[model samples]
Target: MTRRTFLRNVGLATVAHVVGCTKVIPELAALTANSVNSNTESKSGKNKLPKWKGFNIPDYFQPDPWYEIKHTPEEYFKWVADWGFDFIRMPVAYPTYLNISPKKQFISAEDVYKIDENKVEQIEKTIYLAQKYNLHVSLNLHRAPGYCVSTGYNEPYNLWNDKSAQDAFCHHWSFWAKRFKNISTGKISFDLVNEPCYRENINDTKSKTTAVPGTLYHNVAKAATEAIRKENRNFYVIAEANNGYAAPELADLNIGQSCRGYYPYEISHYKAPWVYPDPAYQPTPLWPGNMGGRYYDRAAMEEYYKPWLNLVKQGVGVHCGECGCWKQTPHDVFLAWFGDVLDILTGNGIGFALWELKGDFGMLNSNRSDVQYENWYGHKLDKKLLKLLQSK
Candidate 1:
């Protein structure tokens, strides 16, 4: 179907080319103008999600020639299924599946819809393997058309404010919804975006972060949800929480919600360079102890997650989309804190996905200095952390 027809069917309105900082076609000017009946208290009445526990397979996380290098091995899926886990979140960057001009780091606004079928086929292969191993695949756009939580190539426009960007974002999701229409919701889900926050400067990496306004977030998510459902009404959709911290504003959209487990950044990302930016300032993390001038324990954790739990009570499905500590944190402290994190989330019927499967924050090959690693098929495994996760 043509773009105009697709937008019309989904109730999105757009105009012709609007010249600005870059050549942008100001599409989707008002996502909710005539699209959805805005109702703050109305529930979509979608079924609640099962508490799915698994890890992130970071294969297409960035635009790299070796994009498939980090993909979870087929055996890893078997391990996850064997270990009683039922979910795997694959966070992807848009450029990974697009054929872009090598000279430019960012995709030109006009080229946002162009796709490379070969790259997409690889994505399909991974999903097929995950399903073969009985794992539910949650495909996520970690970096979307015009927004990314981390420092990457500056995008051509702002996803929150740019109509063109919103148009492209919704288009990509709609494309996926149609592509995976044959797959049952029991085996797959689409996480709309990752850690969306309102930044003072959309192009600046260090810009101060704040919660996205509820109306704007709702409009964007609702538009995407509508576009997806236009293709396949049965497809399960999930929206990540505001800034990945606050409760979601999407109960009316009939979709699942996802939140973060990196509550006290001091514990979860101790010396992670991206967060700390300086090694000297990284705090020595301790569980159930005072750090960064605040005391953190099980009580603090419970308080932190109370909002998420309350969202669940309101008939919204909630999950911890990302959690776990960087390798810099001591293993004992990491385990102690994460154990509480898992217990509170799982005990409350919310599930979690560790940030990665074989990386610094994962149970396998974490490369922590304090871990007594077990050699499992040439990969170092943190059995204690594995056992802790399984127990929850």
Candidate 2:
């Protein structure tokens, strides 16, 4: 059975209905009215607003099962506000809302417009909660119709190479733009795509021209940005750097740009099953050691961030959308790396969101085996990391 069908069978329909009627309806109506005014004011002084300081709400729609968001929207938003975060980057998977299956791997542009209402409703509820808690929400398509950063889920054709894939991608984004056109640009924004990294074609470290055809990253991003602008001119659109946020070419698109802080992959992704340095090798990553022929340190991190910084100098807003060291890394090393990264991000006036808030790489209740887990709000809370994030 499909995930939607399963939810219905398990009485999620009833729960959603009750929640909508009791908590969501009134707030949603009020939010819509407030949004119109906010959007106009936000555009007037976009440059003056502080950078987004927040966390990513992972796994809600990136995977099929949707397990990461275990708490109610209210509880989650309250927790974020309580912790002093001002934004939430909510990543979603396109497959969760589409009917396409393994037997039918491709979806037409027509189907792309017919989004699952249930899924949209859940997202709206999240927006409502964000509005209630005064947190900005950045809706990110982590896994777009044609591409995903995660393995085992790539589309049959390259999103950049296939005409149909590009069209479908635009349609998907246009749907959201039209649906939430009334939402305030300050309260809600769109993150065009999660990680537009095509390592085989685009170099990760430098800015290159993506204006050429077949450059899926630039082509799709531009198309989606234009499409979204057509539906809602006031919305802030964010473009992620390619390949671990190492390339800032998309910054030329003249929208908000995002950079990641996962330099020295060995340290950031230590023992990560999906990445290099296999667990069996028992790889030990030192912070200032040589990797890929360059010595890495805080200065290296600052240099690595230069491209995005250049974009900022050109008057484009930049954000550190994803940055975190794994829990398996020594706690002290993790703190040192994170502190340096955070300093660099803040030092440049670039706002940042950690990789997460709860699970691995999270501030509260991370899955670090080395730290003693302390329960707070029904989850493990790493006081040290939490304190570090809050102080910054």
Candidate 3:
């Protein structure tokens, strides 16, 4: 079977498992609620920075061959600041900041991993702009030297297996640490990697091993963290949970843990071009409805977040680094889920940055067919979702 077909089968199997174990939903919800309440009191006065509530600036630095800046950094940063967001998660592609061309034939690993000075200057400018606008920026390496979640690119080495790739990864973070050593942790932070994971079933034992010591990803993260600390001890490090940030590992690192909020993938990613789950068998996604013998609803959403809540209880700073449904999802349904998710995150004092600011899954300016557009920076704004997002 093709990769898409295999993934579709996996999705169907997941739904089957959820349907078969229907009784666990309420149990998970209760656990989440209790954990949220207890952790609220326990986590008091832990970190002085306000919980991150913001949007991701997508397509700015990823997928290489840089795209033209649609909106000026000043415009975007000011917009985020004026909208009351506390931070902006900038997902950057490593190649854009490197000296070597991605297509270049590297004679040696050293040639492959050189940091580019001009690119560094450009990133420094962005940080300065963010500081001027009073917005906290989380610099994230979305596409590192040897790995990227996106397809179509030929990465020469596997970040998980190649020693050179791992060293290069640490070197990149270390360079940034020294470059921005003066920036305060409250104003700038490092998100070690974006959505670190292997393509394994969520419940697979091998996937669980990513959290254990000596695992490739964990080792890389620990090494990078130590490398950054070596330059700037005050820098805040944010680590994403493995497997789409769903698995509850890496809390022991004592750094902030970034979690994803794309639960019930059928609903959040319905009809998304990038997601394929057997179009022949995929059911239309709906909030609080039955899907293949399983009941899916707000409570199920709460259940999905239980693991992250548990991590929060462990005193690890938790942030939903990426969360939001596709624009194609019915606007009302999207709002219902979004509101419930915000309620959960805010109630638990867990912060979140929506999937984007102006693209698909965006709150401020989205390209959903259902909504009437009001042009802002060449894109249309969804005032309804924007208002809801800013609402208490």
Candidate 4:
């Protein structure tokens, strides 16, 4: 059963409904009202407000309650509303927008992936779905068209350092901004670029936490933000730091805006398969100590994410745009870290979404044939953890 149906049957329908939508959620109403006021610029520069205070959003493939999709948008909306999420994070990759030959040769959409048209539509539908569920949506460029600084997906995660590639990347955002101008300042929030990187070279014997293709990220973010701002001024334009891993010690990054600055969610990449794998990935116990845990405990989270937290506190809204683990990690490890991340977020009155509801990330582990999926991994969703996430 869907979480909403499950909750209503248990007597929480009064809190589950959304206006114009069948769901009746006072929390959403209150939240919408709060968002309205929150978006308003405060008269006193000293007073704080929030940009966003909600979840990261479910994966594009899964919006909580699993189901077959005969109609993409309709099925998706039903799926999302069923789940108790206040927002949906729409992670977009750059290739979605393609321009043939900025060169002397003839240019045409033919050079791009055919997936573009339907992809944009799917994104449009997702925003509507979020509203249908009384949830806000963040349109994040997961792996930008070219410059993927981090090494998650198998894409040529390099061009991040190339100028031409970076320009193409910025133009990609411009393309999207134009394509979905309706979503601009409307339902979708813009995220500059995914986690960038500039680390101390290992061989050089100097490594840094929050380091990556420096100005490239900054310029692209500025470019992407400007592009979106030109089209939509009200919607949030989120900025990320190098290493999706939050670094309290980093000097140049500041995601949230409290006059003092803040880093909403600290880098919680410890042990994540994206960064680390099971013992198999790291043959020795001596794994690179660079990244290996969830947010540095709660206080550390507050301290590091606090400056950003103040942005949420200020109403610019802070969205933990991404966070999820693969099946390789131990369930205990997932729970301990996710639980900590969730607690720090809520206790501090921040909002977040699970990295994914389903997909290869193993939020649902479709392939039960695997040992890890059959065993401890599936249990990652402990009752306590599930209940806490559904709380927001």
Tell me the whole-model lDDT of each prediction, alpha carbons only.
0.74, 0.63, 0.64, 0.42
Q: lDDT-based ranking, best first?
A: 1, 3, 2, 4
User: Which residue pairs clash in candidate 2?
Assistant: 61-93, 365-380
Q: Which candidate is the best by lDDT?
A: 1
TM-score of 1: 0.86
lDDT string for model 3 (1-392, tens) is 10011122121111111011111112111123222222233554343224788878754454434233343457878887888877788888776666766454232456546678887787778777877887788899876766555543445665665566667777788788988887676788888877654433322312222321224445567677777766666567888766543434454444677877777777777777657535556667667787667888878878878777766666667778888887778887788778888888777877888888866778655667888777777767888877877883
lDDT of 2 by residue, 1-392 (tens): 11111000011000010000111111111123233212223332233235788888764544433233453447877888988889888877776666544233344545555577876777777777877889998888877765555433435444544566666777788788898898778788888877654322221112222322224455567777777766666567887765444345554454677777777676887776555425867447677666556678888888877777766665567788777876778888888888888887887787888877766678776767788767886888888887888777
Better of 2 and 3 by TM-score: 3
Q: In model 1, which runs have C-alpha deviations exceeding 4 angstroms?
A: 1-47, 63-69, 101-104
Worst 10 residues of 3 by lDDT: 13-22
Best by TM-score: 1
Error of 2 at 143 (Å): 1.2
TM-score of 3: 0.80
Model 4, 154: alpha-carbon shift in Å? 9.5
Stretches of candidate 3 exceeding 4 Å from the true structure: 1-49, 64-71, 102-108, 199-215, 245-249, 277-281, 375-378
Model 4 / residue 63 / CA error / Å: 21
